[model samples]
Target chain A: MPDTGLLLYGGAFGLILIGIAGIVLSAHLVRIIFAVALLEAGANLLLLLATWHQGAAAPIIVAGRVPDLMADPVPQALVLTAIVIGVGILALALSLALRVQRAYGTLDMHEVRRHMEQDIADEAGIDMPSSSHAPAAVQTARQESGA
Target chain B: MQRLSSALFLLGLGLLIAAIFRGMEFGTVAPIVGQAINSAAAEQVGAANFVTAVVLGYRGFDTLLELTILFTAATAGGMVLGKRSPTAKRDPDAGFILQAGADLLFPLLVIVGLYIILHGHLTPGGGFQGGVILASAFFVPILARPGTRMSHTAVSTIEGLAGASFIFIGLLAMFGGEAFLTPLMGQGELGALLSAGSLPVLYLAVGLKVGSELAGLLAQLSESEAVD
Candidate 1:
């Protein structure tokens, strides 16, 4: 029996929480991208909720008559801008993901990270960090040497 | 052990957010600027949609900056996804039904997109929504017929011109002793198609710029070689 406001706020917060969990928990690049999108959507909804009013009509004049109560227009305009920006960022992210997949031949985040670290170390002409999840042989060798 | 930590961290985060939410008031804040804009938008901008007035008339510069961001993202995306090799295998054309459906939907989408954009001042939909539709209109055809390449040169040209004209219109207002992007010309009769002074023109430019930019970006993404 929660009121409309509580329900809306709950939905927005739930979306945000889910999106954050997705971003933090998912290892796949595409999943991460989608999570980012979900987070953006949740944020947009929260923003729109900030100015919510009960029984408010859309902020449009029809037939030369203004309604008794009109919803806030500024937030709507801001949300429109945010949405377009989100789309642009998503497209860029996907393209970058595509490049990363092509370059590394894998989309798994941990594998990609390992490859990238290796590449960077190699470029720097330094040995790979022992702390990294390198091969079992390398780990054993480092452990034996330490012992 | 990792899962346990992650779950604990999420629980803490959720509790924190819930605590924050509990203290805050909802649906009660007075929208000072919104109320002011709603009262004055009709006479000042002559647009039925007050949101449109705020977008193209009051906060036009923000819209312009948004367009720039979209342009930058699209350009960087294109750069990231470089030229598809001539020898790379392309996705085969879709089935006959899909191709036929695409052909059927193309004109309808274009018409609807244009209607939404042109009637933005009086409707719920506006440049951004309509522009996405327009983009899909072009992109759907490419999805159906992979061989039919969209002319990147033409898209870029249209995008550039549309973006320029948006700025040009704003600058024209500056010449007439007003601030940038100030809605010019007669406000005309409210609710009429041609009534919103320069707002409709601004939206037209926005719609075209967004549509072309998106279409080109999509085409580039589709053309890139699929990673195995």
Candidate 2:
């Protein structure tokens, strides 16, 4: 019989794989951030599951009766910390994506990368012959602005 | 082509995970750390909840570092999404139903969050969980009134003071002839609210610090969105 442990491990890794697939296949920056979130959620679930036991109750103490089987408290503590930190990092990622969208006018990863490279090249004063690049409009505009 | 590669990678990863999962045992008893914590936590820390003892007493230093990580993330997020000029347009307000719902639930959420944080020594919830609840409570208003910004100054001060006070309490424990973060006063009867002494106090500091940090993160994200 398949137990809860097997299900948990399977579920967590499944979510992680899905997240990785989303990150790799999706072009939109926002979807990529969501994929990152899925990855974090999977990791959090895995961390929490690592401490589970067969008959263990939650680590909370009742007034009179002492629990015979108490779940491990350390992983709960660790995962609590991870969840908060996950929120922080995800928010950071979202804000960065927002900035990227505002700057480039598109959320497509490829386009953003091309624009970012062009910006860097412009900043470094490297003259990239513009004939080969597809987004020549952005490059030509940069040239026209003398920026 | 891109989707094909991603699918191939995912299949490989899943295979690896399945292989790894097969080795792990299921339905086992608790680990050694849980046993030790359960046995000694009552006598040593005087906290009824072993989880609380682990978080606020045995592993207090790690909790402090966790708070620091949260603080650093908040600071970095604020820097990344710095204040925009006043001319930046605002996000549209939420609809009346959503706004009203948020307003109605906000106070209830705050109270529940406080209960969780305050009763952490005796219950399942603790500083980090309660703090997140409190932070979510604060976020309701932002959803209701799109342009309203949280006070960065207030949030920063709360965060800084709470972190400082956590360290200070640990120092006080050190002065009381115990190791750092050792419960200072006498551990009262188990399951009592004030029984855990420094444990509850540390939890309170943690709750405030985490709540403010998360609320600040939300506010900064909203502010950046509004500017855009």
Candidate 3:
């Protein structure tokens, strides 16, 4: 059998790889977002596992048990920071997807792109807005395109 | 062909996991953890909870950044979802038992969340875990009763207060001439419910802040103006 610490790392890394595969293969935007989130969490867990060894207890200060704090606290701090960032990223992605759904009337990624290309063709004069705030532009363009 | 590719993917994943375990040196690092925690970590940081020591003392700047990350997420999400979403159309049908049970369970969950946050230094759980619990508690009502109304304004108010209190606590620590998150050393009985200085208080504020913010975000997402 493999060493326990490396085993955990392996497990985490495998989960991450699976998550990435899901992101690539899944067509649904929400599923992709979830896949990305899973991958990120797995990465954080793997980083944490690298700092920890077997038989190491949680680094808490207990009376009469002034055991050496063997585990790396660096990973804990990093994971906490990552968790917050992950939450932010997920929320933003969901909100954007929601906006996309509202504007294009369907979440099929290709369909939305096609709609935009049509808009660009019709409007020929003005360059398209950046993707982040495309809805505002699409709303205006749709009024003119009327197709 | 698709099945073959999927089979290959799974096999590759298995091999990768096997490799990580095979390569790691697990036991050699044990002594290092002991040394870091027992003498060097404890004395250098004058706090009882070692995790707190790590979080508030050693990597306090990281904690500050984490808080800002949450703030940024809320702001970005709000901007995308809009500050105010239309109220959702009421479902108008709620089971009596679910409504009654949720009404009772809500306060209980809030209380438990508060208790966990306050006693974090003494107990197993801490602010983040407790915060999620509190959010779930609030979520019960929305699950059972579609007609139930949650005021975004009220949620925002609660969130603001909780956030301010967290900052205020940090300021208190700075004013006392310690580092940004230095636990305000108190003579309270160690291992008691209310010992360990400002750690418990900080945890409480964090729990409340996270819980309210998450709840507000959820309420905002599902909220659409109740269509006539």
Candidate 4:
């Protein structure tokens, strides 16, 4: 059986891998946001594990008794700060996603990207580059125009 | 082809992480500062929880900046969400069970949150953890009754005052010829509630600031008009 350290490390890394995979593979904006959160959580865990000791107690003094081996307080403090920041970022991301959904009427990543590109092109007063996958009629019309 | 490339990328990332993990020497790195703090924190900061001491004492600036970050994010989120349309329909009240549960949970959560915040220096819980519970205390009611709006004025007022008081307390320490955020007042008895000097006051400010900011942000998110 793997040691507890190995298991804990594995879980953290696993969360990071899954989060990255979700971000890369998922096509929904909300899923991507959630993946980002997962990645943040994994990173926080990894940070806390950086100063891990085998038999360390929490870094707290109880009733004038100090433990022989106490966990590092710095990383725990840092992780606490990081977690709050993560929640703030997540809330902002969700709010942004809500706004995007309101503006474009869809949450599908591809559809949103397409709409964004079209909006940019329109704003720039330039025609969008025609895709090879354009409808046959549209392609024929483009060929006939030759402009 | 895209999927294949994505899979290859992920596999490479996993291998890289695993390699780094294996290379790291766990349980061996000397925590020099941590050990020093462990020994000296009781006399210096007088907080039973060394983590709280480190958070609100040694690294108070970092905590302050973190609060600023939270404030910035909440403000930007609120701006992006904008105001709800006057005629936009609100979600109907939740079922009987949820309404009852939310009501039942409110006072209990507030008490627990305050307890955590008050005992932050003595135990594991602190401003951020307790603040989240306090936020939920307000947010739960909004979840149950969408028609009832939180008083944004009250939330913003609490948030502003709490944040100001945090900085004000830090400045107070500076007035006494100490560095910014140096814990003032004599370090009282270790492991006592009234000990830790200004740390608890700072944490009280932190908890209230975080609680109000989060509760307001959540209310804004929930009250926004639904996408058709």
lDDT of 2 by residue, B1-228 (tens): 446767888788878887887776654634888778888888888888887888888888888888887788788878877777777678889899999999999999999998999988988887888999999999999989987889989998998999999999999988878888888788899888888778888898999999999998887777763532
Each candidate's chain A: what TM-score?
Answer: 0.88, 0.83, 0.75, 0.88
Give the CAPRI rating of model 3: acceptable
TM-score of 4: 0.94
Model 1 CA deviation exceeding 4 Å by range: A130-147
Give the least accurate 10-residue stretch of model 2 chain A, judged by summed lDDT: A138-147
Find the candidate with the highest DockQ and give its number.
1
In model 1, the clashing pairs are none
Error of 3 at A48 (Å): 1.3
How many clashes (backbone N, Cα, C below 3 Å) per candidate? 0, 0, 13, 0
Residue pairs that clash (backbone atoms under 3 angstroms), model 2:
none
Per-model C-alpha RMSD: 3.2, 4.4, 6.6, 3.7
Q: Which of candidates 1 and 4 is the stronger one according to TM-score?
A: 1
> Quick one: RMSD of model 3?
6.6
Please estimate how well model 1 matches the true structure, expressed as its whole-model Cα lDDT.
0.92
**lDDT by residue for model 4 over B74-121, one digit each (tens)?**
999999999998999889899999999999999999999999999999
Per-residue CA lDDT of candidate 3, range A73-122, in tens? Answer: 55665676577668768878998888777777777654677677768867
Ranking of models by lDDT: 4, 1, 2, 3
Give the per-residue lDDT digits (tens) of candidate 4, residues A30-137. 999999999998999999999999999999888888899999999999999999999999999999998898889899886787788779999999988665888676
TM-score of each: 0.94, 0.88, 0.79, 0.94
**Which ranges of candidate 3 are over 4 A from the true structure?**
A62-64, A68-70, A119-147, B1-48, B83-88, B187-189, B225-228
